[model samples]
Target: MTIFAPTTDSHEQQAPPAARRRRRRVGVMSIVMLAFVALCGYLVGGFLRFTEEVNLLAKPAAFAAADGIVVLTGGAWRIDHAIDLLKEGRGRRLLISGVNPDTSVDALARLTDTDRKWFDCCVDIDYAAQNTVGNAEIAGRWAREQGFRDLILVTSDYHMPRSLIEFDRVGNIRSVTPYAVRRDDLWRGDEMPSAPGLRVLASEYVKLVAARFLSTVGIVAKQSVSTRVADLAE
Candidate 1:
């Protein structure tokens, strides 16, 4: 009987490719897990910071006058508060940005139970904006054209930070006084938050982080609002 000697090379060749593949997969999975953990940490940190910032609106001081008032339409209270400010002589012009295209001035007047004269005289509605980003761009352009140096920016408390950042990106308006619309029990520590409220807060936090990233990357700075809208249309 002829016995073949086992060589080192043969033993090495006998190692299963499947084992190597398994090792490689484990390495990739470990890297992915680490990345996921990092992202979660960042999001949690951002959410905490966002909550702190929004809470500051609980005790707002009296805001001085500005050249114009820009109310981003989302909640009914935001519109009402902005209108109250306008009637109080907070600003010379009131720009109701992000109005629904189908919504007429009369409809808004009816919703707020205001006189038609308010819309006819001081209020200007922009149907161009579809979101907060659009609101900033269209409103910024209007403010620039009208030579408004100062503007009061109104939105929900959670939304104010991101909106201010977007508006500031335009660099046209000299000053923006933020007026947050209070939502009753929005952040009451005494009670557990509703699912819907938590979801909204989480979403806004993500948006705030994204806006900051885009602002830092110079992407937001380079593109004009009209250009973005035209691109979206195409």
Candidate 2:
């Protein structure tokens, strides 16, 4: 008789706090998964666009004269091509932005099959730059020293976009004409890109995106670059 009142149905019972927490956690996880998927789609789209743009640079541009030429050291072909541009009078001076610290001007000229007179008269080398940012900063400084407002930027095709970003951020050279070098390792024989080519593109794409983002966000601080202008006399 004391417990005469009917008990509430189990359906009427409120969920426990722990159950609510689990439900909330599941909802959050679902949202995170959706965001992750969306991000992946976006990145894949960007990668495709990057590849297309890089491929299009294969169409050669008309050579326009600039105050100076700057080549980012990668392969012998790149250096040789830049030197050829110099010979064509496309630029008054050629600044090789990244050179081996141990490699003297004599060695570089000899190795590139360049005439020693070219190095002595019109070519300058920078031994300080270790990466793209360094290359931009070093090249900017060299351009300023040479009173050059326009520059011809030489680098591999895939590297052109990123190089442009850095050069733009550096902001001293008023004009830049890109000379994209064709790489034998990429786009083999009108076929689909090889695994290694894809890998290289992916790496470069990520870096390019990062550079664009950082530069946009105003988070790109001037890097402390120790510049070593190679003595052409050496």
Best by TM-score: 2
Model 1 stretches with alpha carbons more than 4 Å out: 1-32, 189-193, 220-234
lDDT of 1 at 127: 70
Off by over 4 Å in 2: 1-13, 221-224, 227-234
| Tens-digit per-residue lDDT, 8-35, candidate 2 | 5442346677877787799999999999
Please provide TM-scores, in order, for all candidate models, with all chains considered together.
Answer: 0.78, 0.86
> How many residue pairs clash (N, CA or C atoms closer than 3 angstroms) in each of the candidate models, in the order given?
0, 0
After superposition on all CA atoms, what RMSD does each candidate show versus the true structure?
A: 6.6, 5.1
- Give the best candidate by lDDT: 2
Worst 10 residues of 1 by lDDT: 225-234
